[model samples]
Target chain A: MAAHNTVATSNARKQVAAGGWLWGAVRRNGAGYLFLAPWLIGFFCLTLGPALVSLYLSFTNYDLLTTPEFVGMQNYVRMATADPKFIASIRVTLLYVALSVPLKLAFALAVAMVLNRGMRGLPFYRAIFYLPSLLGTSVAIAVLWRQLFAADGMVNSLLAQFGVEGPSWISNPNYSLYTLVVLSVWQFGSPMIIFLAGLRQIPVDMYEAASLDGASPARQFFRITLPLLSPVIFFNVVIQTIEAFKAFTPAFIISGGSGGPINSTLFYTLYLYQEAFSYFRMGYASALAWVLVVLIAVFTAFSFLTTKYWVHYDD
Target chain B: MTDAVHEVPGRASTHPRLTGTVRHVLLIAISFVMIYPILWMLSGSLRPADELFGGDAGLMPSQVTLQAYSDGWFGLQVTFGRFFANSLIIAVLATVGNVLAASLVAFAFARLKFSGQKFWFALMLGTLMLPYHVTLIPQYVMFRSLGWVNTWWPLILPKYFAVDAFFIFLMVQFFRGIPRELDDAARMDGCSPWRIYRKIILPLSMPVLATAAIFSFIWTWEDFFGPLIYISEMSQYTVQLGLRSFIDSSGTSSWNELFAMSLLSLVPIFLIFLFFQRLLIEGIATTGMKR
Candidate 1:
């Protein structure tokens, strides 16, 4: 038993002596890697592997059934020079991001401000507002949207009662995209919730002091509210812009997955899905996908770059 | 929040600027618009078919019927029950996969002093912004080759490997909030790191875990795109897919029955939202910290 103990001690000392810092780290941090194994495996195999494969696939002329053949810059060239629907999709998405983000933010802030005033049944009111965000992108909601905007649907019925004429919102090229924009804006609960959290962080004394100084409510809002909430607003802008860029389901379902009514609602992802699945042009779709990522990255970078000008964190 | 209380101790949060009837009136009106569609849908689903489009649209249907519910039960090649089962199996398994795997990976990042931790954390964050579409076709091809297409494997299995970076980031944030003293005390007692995690970390972190589970269930339940791309078999269709199959907007769709089934599909998420709104809202609020 003593000999066994001495052997064990000697082995431990040898392990301590061996490989110096590397082995020490391996022993110390091995559990971390073990814990991280699932994520690491996923990071490499699912995310990085697929990402790299798509990058390579973007340069190939692969259909789903055929082996991808190297085609260099052909896909990129076609996307930039040949695809009009591509340009239209980009335009629609950009217009969407431009219109929806500000409106949604404005609407969300307005509601959040009202709710912030210690309303009765605050939780219930908050829940009612938030219900749209939860249901906004669901298949049910999309279906409901299609019907509600149809010429004979409830919206038109409501308009008839008001003695105003309404177009078939989904089928009219002019109004098709705006219908989606409204739906997107309607889900403003997310940002509203976040805004509420940000509002909670603001010191109410600032408002009280400003009021005591005879500053108008508008003056206090401009001086105090906007600056303090800028970071949260920035957060909302970045997230919503990215979300707008990726808007797919409502367009897919409502516009019948073809982004019809003159391609006005052809969100980028919807078009990409068709290119890959419908046409089986996986390579072209891959190129479109890369362009989307680059577009999002550029916008995100732009937001971050401009944030210092507007988002005051030091207060 | 403290300042709000300090300034208006008498009435917790009422703003002095906004007062009485007018504010409530405007709020009630806007609230009506916000909630109108759902109320309309609930009523529409319950209404008789002829009454659906006629007269003023109101929640009061002259006469209601259960016909839509029964017919929509097996309206397609499969039944709504099958779709519900499919969704339930996928969601429950996914919730389990996400909660366990995310918490495990989170434990590594939050507690263990590992090399390349910051790099990996940033990489994880990068994945949060990486839209699933960029990875969609390639994953489809991969899963197609592996014979995972039409099976729930493609939708369900990646979750087991902690592929959802959002959930991991959430869990990481949560694990960081847990005190380290329990870990230290456990280590001093000659407990393995795994023991520290399983015995101490898991028990105390129930609220965050509950948040993750609740979210995973709802998101998976509502997930339209993943299943849309992956599964084509009617037998394998999730609730969203089943609901979509009922919709042929340009064709003959049983609108009343579709509404009934849609309402049925919504019940789980609505229930989840109703019961767990506080946790869900708080979880999302903290996660909005990520951006």
Candidate 2:
């Protein structure tokens, strides 16, 4: 009985100590917490909460009007087996990511390298190049792109001077996706700016030393420039690839929201939008959303995992 | 030093003047190609509808007219002026909210010490890479349930809450660059953290604040998907939606007018870009390099 009484007293003392620590922490962090309240509220209400709810919704069948019914991996199964549109979207999106990202990065790097050469009017050139990236995602640009790729549009009209008739690029499934890729590549300005910044960080003496050693410019680029720029390249690759995956407007507007010409331009996000908003398959769309999340997570993780092999750090 | 290093090889191989001329020519050609489409669109908008297509590929209108612009402005039931007003209100509110809330959150992260701060910051960065689609559906449902489906609240309210982690990250980086001695001096004067944030930090953070505001306005103005999903009412349409409706409702019949309105839609962004080019470039460069 005396031992039990001692234990109860110790427990009470511990509770008081814990409470005091909690109170002290609150007092110490009150101002910080106050500053963070808005963001904390947004994070909880909008991002994290919605993400968790979507994960749950992915397992159900919901249409916004009806209560969600548990489906137990049916959406996943259907996507793998039954849905050809899903397959087509995955194929198109993968093709886009595979094509656009490298091409954009290559173009960006090439431009950045050229501009890095102590050229006059660097700001003028940079601004001109960056203009496309700023306007690339707007509806106006998408509308312009459609007209520019129409059968009798500017591209074909330009080609007409060579006496070669270009097909309606926007309508041709074989070429529709390529038009989107070109649009993505045209916005290489942002990445070019990034590459230029990265290039600026490289020591000029390295190049001078390489030149002194009789290394050709090409040789110097491969040996010194590439290794040094690998981190920036990796960053651009991951970012551009993810962006290429999420590309919707150009595809949506170009395809007229149909993902047509046999789903050639059916970007994953476009397909997801159609399913959720157009078809009101909220649950299935949630599942699609999760799949995208997983795909991006995997891609990012894979990039990180593979970084040691190629991405170099000064440290 | 860089100029000298760059000149050394050029001087050895060829005349520096000759190389400079060649470089200028190459850059000029590339710039022309880069901006040709916009120039072409501008020309198209100036031409009569009959001459819009099947014309020469050159960016010069045979006969310029303001017919397309006037027609486009009053083409829809709700004038393009209304859409511009709607877009301006939303963009301005979003920019103000983003700059204010993001700065506040960024101040906390950069200046103050608190428990779980590291974890929260990590989570915030994680959201940067997390695609919007994951939370998109649930957010739609939430907004719809709150009857925000056809309102600008869904568009503008999120900004007030600092959902744009990119701006927060950008501001945090800028804030860290600020010397903390000022804050310490303010504290020595018995100023509170809020006072220091207002007096010391914000006053010194004009560059980053301007950067955030410009980007936020441009992005909000260009945002098609958010307004597309939330707003279906034609009268409440933003500029992007208004332009899209012009395409759907008129098709190719009013191509010149479409081009005119499209060009008009881009004017605000173009003006901002024209003025804030330096700030925009610096913002992107600093943030990108710091990464």
RMSD of each: 5.1, 3.4
DockQ for candidate 1, C-alpha atoms: 0.50
Model 2 RMSD in Å is 3.4
Q: In model 1, which runs have C-alpha deviations exceeding 4 angstroms?
A: A1-22, B1-18, B52-55, B249-253, B289-291
Write candidate 2's Cα lDDT for A1-315 as tens digits.
999999999999999999999899988899899999999999999999999999999999999998999999999999999999999999999999999999988998988988996688999999999999988789999999999998889999999999999999999998999998899888889999999999999999998788777788799999999999999999889888888888888888888899978999999999999999999999999999999999999999999999999999989
Q: Measured against the native two-chain assembly using Cα atoms, what DockQ does each of the candidate structures obtain, in the order listed?
A: 0.50, 0.61
The DockQ-based CAPRI class assigned to model 2 is medium
lDDT of 1 by residue, B117-156 (tens): 9999999989999987778889999999999999999888
Best by TM-score: 2
- Model 1 error, position A230 (Å): 0.5
Q: Point to the candidate with the largest lDDT.
A: 2
For all predicted structures, in order, the TM-scores are 0.93, 0.95
User: What docking grade does candidate 1 earn?
Assistant: medium
Compose the digit string of candidate 1's lDDT tens values, residues A1-315.
999999999999888787676778899879989999999999999999999899999999989997999999999999889999999999999999999999999999988887785667778878888878877677988887887888778888888888877888899999999999989988988889999988888898888788766688788788899999999999999998998898888999888788998999999999999999899999989999999999999999999999989998965
Native contacts recovered, each model = 0.58, 0.73
